[model samples]
Target chain A: MPILQFVERDGILDLGWGHPRPGLLPVRQWQDATRAALDAYDWQALTYGHSAGPQPLVDWLAEHLGTVDALTASPGEFFVTAGASHALTLCATVLAAPGDVALVDVPTYHFALRILRDRGLRLVPVPRDDAGIDVEALGALVDRLRGDGQRIGLLYLVATFGNPTGLSVGEPRRTELVRFARAAGVTIVEDDTYRELGYEGAPPASLWSVDPGGPVVRAGSFSKTVAPGLRLGFVQAGPDVLDRLAGIGYVDSGGGLNHSVALAMATFARSGAYAEHVARVRAAYRSQRDALVDGLRAGVPGLDVPRPAGGWFLWLRLPEGMTAESLMVVAERNGVSFAGGAQFHTDPARGHDHIRLSFSLLSPAGLTDAADRLAAAIRSVAG
Target chain B: MPILQFVERDGILDLGWGHPRPGLLPVRQWQDATRAALDAYDWQALTYGHSAGPQPLVDWLAEHLGTVDALTASPGEFFVTAGASHALTLCATVLAAPGDVALVDVPTYHFALRILRDRGLRLVPVPRDDAGIDVEALGALVDRLRGDGQRIGLLYLVATFGNPTGLSVGEPRRTELVRFARAAGVTIVEDDTYRELGYEGAPPASLWSVDPGGPVVRAGSFSKTVAPGLRLGFVQAGPDVLDRLAGIGYVDSGGGLNHSVALAMATFARSGAYAEHVARVRAAYRSQRDALVDGLRAGVPGLDVPRPAGGWFLWLRLPEGMTAESLMVVAERNGVSFAGGAQFHTDPARGHDHIRLSFSLLSPAGLTDAADRLAAAIRSVAG
Candidate 1:
C-alpha cells in the first residue's frame, strides 16, 4: 500500500478532504484499461507526442464534451494538460503577467488562491450570489482595478457545481459574463472540473460553449468524474490561446505532458466505460449528499445548509455569531474535521461564519455518522 | 496508431531525430511495470500526492541515483518532475526571472535553446572545446556579462555524454566549474538526462555529485535511459532549492507532477529492471556508435568526425568553407537528414560548418547506410 496523502486519526471522520471515497475509484477498470492500451500500443505512443497532446485523446475529449455541452466541439479548441491545476498555472504564468490582477470569485477553491498568489498574480475578490458570480460587481471591480492602473489579466470562476460553495452560475448570467469579458478584453478561465457531477438535471450552458469561440477558456478534468491519479486534463480554448500555451518553454521541451496516460485514457474513454463509471459515481454521491443533509438538519438546530444539486461539498452557514474557527476546535474534539471557510476567501472576515463539509469521501451511513458528530460539535461550540 | 509526432518522409533516413529506436524502447517491460504498480497501489496512489512527490518514489530514486553516482543521495534532495525538459522549464520559469542572463554551452541541444529562449531568458553562449565548456572563457564571460549589468540567473550544462557533441566534461573540469559556480553565487542547472547511457566505461563523475549540497541543481530523467513517454524525472538539489521548486503555483495546486508514473517507475527501479535495462542499452548504443563512426570514416574523406564515448549523436565538421546549410540540400536528395549545427547556437554563424547525426533511432546497419548517404551528400556539396 502507498503512504496516505493526508494525516489521519483513529475514530475521526475526515469531512475536510473533497475527494471521492476509496470504493468509488475504478481500480479494476484502470487495470483493464492499461492492458487494453498496451495491447493496442504503437511505438509512437511512447515517443514525444504532439505538443497539443495526443490527437486521439484530444478528439475523444472533444466528442465527449461536445455531447455534454450540446454543441459542435472542434478538436482545435482543445489542448490536453496534466490536470486542471496545471492548466491554471498556464493561465497564471503564461496568459497573465506577474503583478496583473486576477479577478476571482469571493470564496474560491482555497488551493487555487495559493496557485495565483504563488505565481505573483494579485487576486482581487469578486462577490458571488446564489446564481454565482455577481456580474455587475465583477465588472465594477474590473473597472476599478483598471482605473487604478492595474491590468486585468484573467477572470477565474468555478462556474458549475463549484467547490466550497457547490453553486452553479445561472444560464443567462453565463452569457452576460462571457459577453462582458470579451468586450473588456479580459480572459475568463472556467475551472469546469465539477461540470459533469450534477446529480439532478442538466448543468447550464458552459461559458466556453455559450459563445463557442470567445475569451472563456476552460480547464476540464477527469479527476472528479474518473480519477485524479490519471493526472490528465485538457484546455478548451480558441486556436490562439492554445498556440500560446503549447509555445511555452516546458511544453515545447516535452512534446506533450502525460502522452502515455493520454493514450491509455483515450482507450478507456472510447470503450464507453468512462461514461458508465461517471453515471454510477453521480448516483452514489447524490445519496451521500442526502444523508448528510438529513442528519445535520435533525441534529443541529437553526443551522443553514444549502443542499448542493451536484458535486462534493456542502456549504453551511452556522448559527448567528458562530465562527468556523470556534466550531473547528469542538468539531475535532467530537471526532469530525472540516475546512474552515475563512481560508477560502481573500478577505477572511467575509467567511468567518461559514464551514465547508464534503460528502464525497464517505458512504451515506458514514456521512450520516459524520453529520451527527459534527452536529454535536456545533452544539457544544455554540452553547 | 495515434497521430505522428513528427512528419515522416517516405524514403528518408531520419538521423536528425534523437531518441531510442523502436527496438530499444522496452514496451513489454513498461506493461509489466504498470501491472506491478497496479497490484501494489493504495487508493491514495490515485489521489493528489505530496507536493515533493510520493515519498516511496523519492526514496527509491535516492537509492538508485546514489548507487549510480557513487554518492549517498538523500531523499531530502529530490523533487519529482515530468521529465528533464519539464525540469528545465521549472528552472527557466521558476528559478530564474525573465530577464536574467542564461550562460549555456555552444552547440548544445537545439531544443534546449528554444526552451530557454521561450521562457524569456537571454542566452549568452559559453564556448567549448574537446574538454567541454571552457572554464577560463566562462569565467571571463561571467565577468564580462556582470560588468555589463546583467544578472546571471543560471548556467545550464548537459555535463554527462551531452547532446549533439556527445562529449562529457572532463572530471577535473566538472569539479572546477562546480566550485566556480558556488563561489560566484551562480546556480548551475545541470541537465543530467544522458548520464546513464555510457558505453566504454562508467562516465565521468556528475557535476551535482562533484560537489554535493552546493548551488548545483540537476534534472535527471528516464526519457533517455528508459522511455520518453513515461514523462517521469526528478530534481536533485539542496533543501532551500527544493523548497523553492515545490512552493511554485502549479506544483502547489497539483500536489505532484506525474504521481502515478512515479509510482510505476519506483516499482521498475526497485525490481532491478532499470539498471539491467540500461546495461543492455549501453551495449547496444556502443556498437551503433561504432558502426556510424566506421562508415563515416571510410566513406567521407578529409572530414572531421569526433568519436563519442557514449550517448547519441555524431558531431561532424566539413573539411573547410562548406556550411551545414549547403550539405543539407544534397543530403536530402541522397535520402538522409541531419540537424544543422547553426540552430544549436546563440549566434547561428558560429555553428554554420557543423552537422549533428544521431545513431539512437536506427539499427547499426541502418545507421551505417545513413552515414554513407550523409558522406556522399557532404562530398557532393564540397565538390
Candidate 2:
C-alpha cells in the first residue's frame, strides 16, 4: 500500500475514508506555485519563520477568511496550524487538560473522537438534528455534567458543513452556540474546515463571525479545497487564544510547523489560484455527491437518505429494523465499504443504525457503482 | 516584513539567532526536489500519509542514519517529526508530565530551555565539562532528586554538536548515560540534529547506537543539513517510544506532519543530493568557523576561544573580570550582536562571563568582520 492511501484492492470499493480523491490532486498547480514562491521569496523563506506564520499567507488568510465568513477579519486573529487536526491537537494541548470533558456532536467526525481520547480527554456526545447541534440539549448536558463535577473544557463543533452528518447550525443556533459557551464557561471550537465547499451557497455565518472575540476558535483548512498533503491550515481565533497557542512548546520552539509549504500557499492564494482551485474542486465534489445520493435513493428501496447541503458525506439513517453493523458486513460481501455510525459516537449504544458515506474520494460513476453495491448490501441485511 | 526572518539592517551583524544563513538556503535544490517528488509520487503523496511517515523517506532515513551512527538501523524504529524542536515537544508531551523534573545541560540551546519551560517541565541544570555531561554527578543528582520526592522525567541532551557550545558526549560516557537512564528509570532524548554536519571526521557513535532499543531516543533533523523551513526531522528509538509518538493526538489525527515536504526529502536523499548538500554545508561552515576564530584570536589579546569540531557556534570564555553582559553592551555599539550565555542557563545566576557566537548565518568574511567587531568590544569592555 502507498503511505498516503491504500492501493487498489481486488474488488472492494473504499468509501470508508474521508481523504480527498486521488484524481483531483493538482500536481501542475503545485509545481507552478512552488516555482513562483521560490522565485518571489528566494532563500529568505527557508529559515526559522515567525511563529505566527508566513506574513504573505497570514495576511492573505485574514482576507480570505473575511470573505468566507462574510465579515472583516484581521491578520491578528489567525494562527497557522498544520491542519484542522493539528489545530484541534494544539488547542487540546494548551487550552484543555487531561480528563477534561470535550462535548462533541453525536455522529461527529469519528477520527476526532479518537484524537481527543488520545489526549486523555473524556468525550461526551450531544444530540444533533439535520440543521446541526441542538444548543438546548448541549446546554443541558453541560449543566448536567458540571453538576456531576465534570469540567467541560470545550464543545467541538463542525458548525459549517460538518463531517459525517453534513450539517450546519442555523445562524441563530450559531449565536446560541457562542452565547452558551460564555454562559457555561466553555470554549466552542468551530471547525470551519468545509465552509468553502458549501454547494447550497454558504451554510451559515461562522460562530467566530457571530462573536469575533467570544469563546469561539474557528479552524480553517486548505485540505479540502487545496491538497491534504500540503498539511497546512489556520485557526481563526481571538488574541488570547493565539497567545496561548504561540506560547506552547511546539510553536515557541519551531515557529510555524510548515514554513516552506506556507510560502507556496501564500503565492498560490495571492495569485488567485487557490480560489479557482476551490471552485473547481467544489464543482467536482457537488457532482459526485449528487450522483451518489441520487443512486442511493433510486436503487435502495425505502432508504431515507438526507441530501447533504455541502461537504463530502451523506448520512443514511438505516432502513427500519436494519443496523449499520449488519449492513457493513453485507456491504463488504457486495464489494462496498463505509464508515459505520458507531465509530463516530462517543457513546457506543447510540448510532447503531446510521452509516456515513464519503462522496469526495471517487468519481461520480464510481460512486454510482458504490451506491448500487451498497443498495444490494442493505437489501440483503434488511431481509 | 518577512515572517520567517529578519531583513538586513543597515550596519548590524546578527550572530544571535542559530537560523541557517540566507545565502546558503538552497532554494534551487528544494525546487528541484519538489518537482521530482510530485512526478515520482503523482497524487499519491497528496493525501493523509502514514502516521510513522512516508515509507520511502522512512526507509532511506533508516539506512542513512545507520551510516551516520556507525550501526545498523531499521525502518520500524524511526518516527518522522516536523523538526528537532518538535521531537522535544512530542516527547515532553508523552514521556513526562508538567512539574516533572527535567535534567538539562547547562548553557544549552536557549530556545530549548524556553520550550521545555513552557511545557511546564521544571529544569535543573546539570553541570558540564569540555568532555560533555558528567554521568557520575548526574546519577547522584537523580538519586538526590528522587530522594526529595521529585519525579525526574527525562534528561535532554544534544549528544553531538550541541548548540551554543559545540560539544559531544564521548563514546564510553554515552554508554554510561544509557546505563544511568536504565538504573534511574528515565528516558534520554539525544538530539542528534547536527550529527551529520560534522566538519571533523565524525562525532562519537550516537547514544541510541551505543544501546539500540534501550532508553535513548535520537532526534535527527534536515534543518541543519538542508533547510530549516522544511520542518522535517525524525526520531530513532525503540518500539515503545515510536508507539508512544505515533499514538499522540496530533500524529493519529493528521497522519504525519509535513508529508509533502517529506516526499520531497525522500527524493533528495535517495538521489544522493542530500549527501552532496551536507558536504557542501559542512565545508562552508568549517571555513566560516576558522575565519572567525582566527580573526578573534589575532584581533583580541588573551581571548580564550575553543575551536568547535562541528556545527555552528564557538564558545568564547570571557577574559578575567570581563562579563558577557558588559561585552554585549560594547559589541552592540560596534555593530555586532551575539547571544549572551546567561540566556542558556536554567538558573539566572550562572553563565555570567561566557558568550556564544553562531558561525552559520554569515559568510566567512562577514564572520571575520563580526569577530573584529567583537574583539573591539572585548577590549573596550575589559578597560
Candidate 3:
C-alpha cells in the first residue's frame, strides 16, 4: 500500500488524461493577463461573474464558432462550466431527470457516460460504426426504449472528432440524427470538444448549426483549442434549456469566473496566432497518430489500429489472445501507459479487448518511444 | 417578454451574495501573484490541472480545514472542485440515484435545495430550530419515509453557520445526525461554506472532523472567506466516492481550478490574513445584523426578523396581511433589494411569507439605508 496510491501506476505516458497539451499552453500571455487582472480587476474578479461565464469569452466564441444561422446566441444563451466535462454534467443535471434515459453512442466518451450515470440516467447505448454513431440505429434505440415505456430525455453525440473513436458524425447522418431526435422528442447534446482538431476537409456543420429549429444543445471548449487548464468552456443551449442551466450555475459559482482566463482565452482567440497554434497542435497529433498506427502495423502486427481523421487518440484492438488488463501490466513494467479499454466502457465485459492510446499528450519523439515501448509490451504479453 | 428575467425583484440590497466582501478583495497582492505565476509558471499553469482541482490548493485546504484527522486523508481523500456548489452537484451525482431521496434541512441553503431538486431527488425537508437541522424530526421523517419504502440515499446539511438560518449544529445533534445517517445507511454531505465567519464561540468541530470514521462527505470553500468570485472550493469524501467524483469532474473544466486562485488562497491562509480578515467581516456583519434587527423593531413594528447567529442574512417573516411579492415591489420602489423567500424553497406555498436579506454586501451606511427602505416598504404595504 503506497501513500500516493490513488495515482495508481505512474510513468505510463497517460494518454488517458484529456488536458490540453502542455506545450500548447499560452503560459506567458495568460500569466500577463492574470497579473493585470489581479492588479486592476481583482475586486470584481474575485466575486462571482455572470453565470454564463465571462461575457468577452462568450462574445469571442460566438464570433469564432461560425455556426450557421440555425445557431445564434444571446449572452444569456451561453453558460460557462468548469470544463467540457462540467458542461456535460450541467447538461445532465438540467436535461436528464431521475428515471429518464439518455441515448448515448456505444463506445462513446467515457466521461459523458459517467456523467449520465452519475445523474441516475439509464444509459441506452446507440450502436455506432466507423461512420460515427448510427443515425438509423439511434432512431431504433429511441423507439425501442420508448416502447419499453422509457422516456428518452436526450441523445448525446459528438458531432466532430469524438473521443475513444476519433470519428466525426458525417453531415447526412447529422441531419438524420437531428430529425430523429426532434421526431422522438429527444433533445440532442452535441459535444463538439474536438471540433478544432479536425484534420479532414472542412468539418461538418454542427448539429445545432444545421437544425433549423430543433432541440439541440451545442457544447464546445477552450480545453482542446486553447488550454483545458484555464477551465473555461461554454454550452449554447436553446433558451429554455440554457435558462435552466444558468439557474443551476448561478447556485454553483455565483457567476464567479476567472476573468483572466476569459481574458487570456479572448486574447488567444484574437492573437491571429490561434490558427497557427491550432495547426501546430493538430500537425503534432496528426503525426503522432500516423506514427502510433504505423508502429502497430510495422512493429506489432495483428493489433487492429484505427487511423483517426483528427484528435489525439488511437483506439487499438489487441490480437486475439491479448487483453487490455494484461497489456496494461506489461506496459507499466516497460514505462509506457495507456487507458485500459475496460475502464472506458459502460459495459466492461464488452470493452476488455480494446485500449485507447492518446498521441496528443506526448511529443512526437515521446510518442514514438511510447509506441515502441507499448508495441514491445503488447507483443511480449500476447506471445 | 424580456429576454432575461431575474429573481431579484425586491432587488438584492443586492447582497446575500457570498465570498470575500468586494471591498476587502486583495486586488494588489493578487495582481502580484498572478503576474509571478503567469510570467514564471505560464507553461504549466494554463493547461488542465488534476481533475480534482489544483494539487496545492487541495493540500492547503486539507491542512487549513484541520477538521478531519490526517489518518483519513490518504492520497485520494481530498479533491478540488470548481466551487462548493460544483462539489455538491458532484455529490448529488455520485450519491443519489434517480427515484432516491436526499434528506435536507428545512430552511436550508436555497441553492442546495435547487441542486438536489435539479438532480430529480425529492427533497425530504426536515424542520430546523436554533440548534441546526432538527435531529428528532429527521429521524421520524426517515422512519416514515422508509416505511413508505422510499430509499434516502443522502443526508445533506450545513453544519457551521447553516446558510439562510445562520445556525450551527451543536455537538450532541451532530452526533445524533451521524448516528441517524449510519442507521439509515445514508451518506452525509456536510457543507461548511460559512465556517470561517464564526463571530461567537469557537466554531463547532465538523461532524466529519469528529467522526472521521463515518461516511460524511465534507465540502468547504474560499469563496465565503477569501473570494467567492474566485470559484475555488474542495470536497473531502471517502476515496471511492472521491475517485468517482474526479472522473465525473473531468467533464467540467477538467477540474481545471484557478491555480492563481489556489496560490492566492494559499498565500492568504499562510499569511494569516484570513483570520484577521474574517474577524473584521464578522464584526461588520454582527453590527449590521444588530442594526437591521433594531430598525425592524423600531420601524416595522409587526415584522418578524430572526437575528442570524452567523453568516450575512436576516430571515424575515412578513407581517400579517403582507405578501412577499407585494412587499418586494414596495421595497424595490423604496430603493432596497432582497432575495425573496420563494427562490429558496422547493414548495412555493410554504416560503412566500419569508424574505432573506443580506447585510454583508452593503456598508454600515448602506445597511441603514436598506433597512430604512425595507422598513418603509413594509409599513406602506402592511399599513
TM-score of chain B of each: 0.96, 0.97, 0.86
For candidate 1 chain B, the 10 contiguous residues with the lowest summed lDDT are: B1-10
Instruction: Report DockQ per prediction, comma-separated.
Output: 0.55, 0.65, 0.36
Off by over 4 Å in 1: A1-4, B147-149
Proportion of true contacts reproduced by candidate 2: 0.72
- Backbone clashes (count) for model 3: 24
| CA deviation > 4 Å runs, candidate 2 | A5-8, A127-130, A140-151, A183-185, B7-10
**Chain A superposition TM-score per model:** 0.97, 0.96, 0.88
Better candidate by TM-score, 2 or 3:
2
Which candidate achieves the best TM-score against the true structure?
1
- By lDDT, is 1 or 3 better? 1
Error of 1 at A90 (Å): 1.6
What is the Å distance of residue B381 in model 2 from its true position?
1.4
Model 2 B-chain TM: 0.97
TM-score of candidate 2 versus the correct structure, residues matched by position? 0.96
Q: Indicate the residue-level lDDT of B226 in model 3.
A: 63
Structural similarity to truth (TM-score) of each candidate: 0.96, 0.96, 0.85
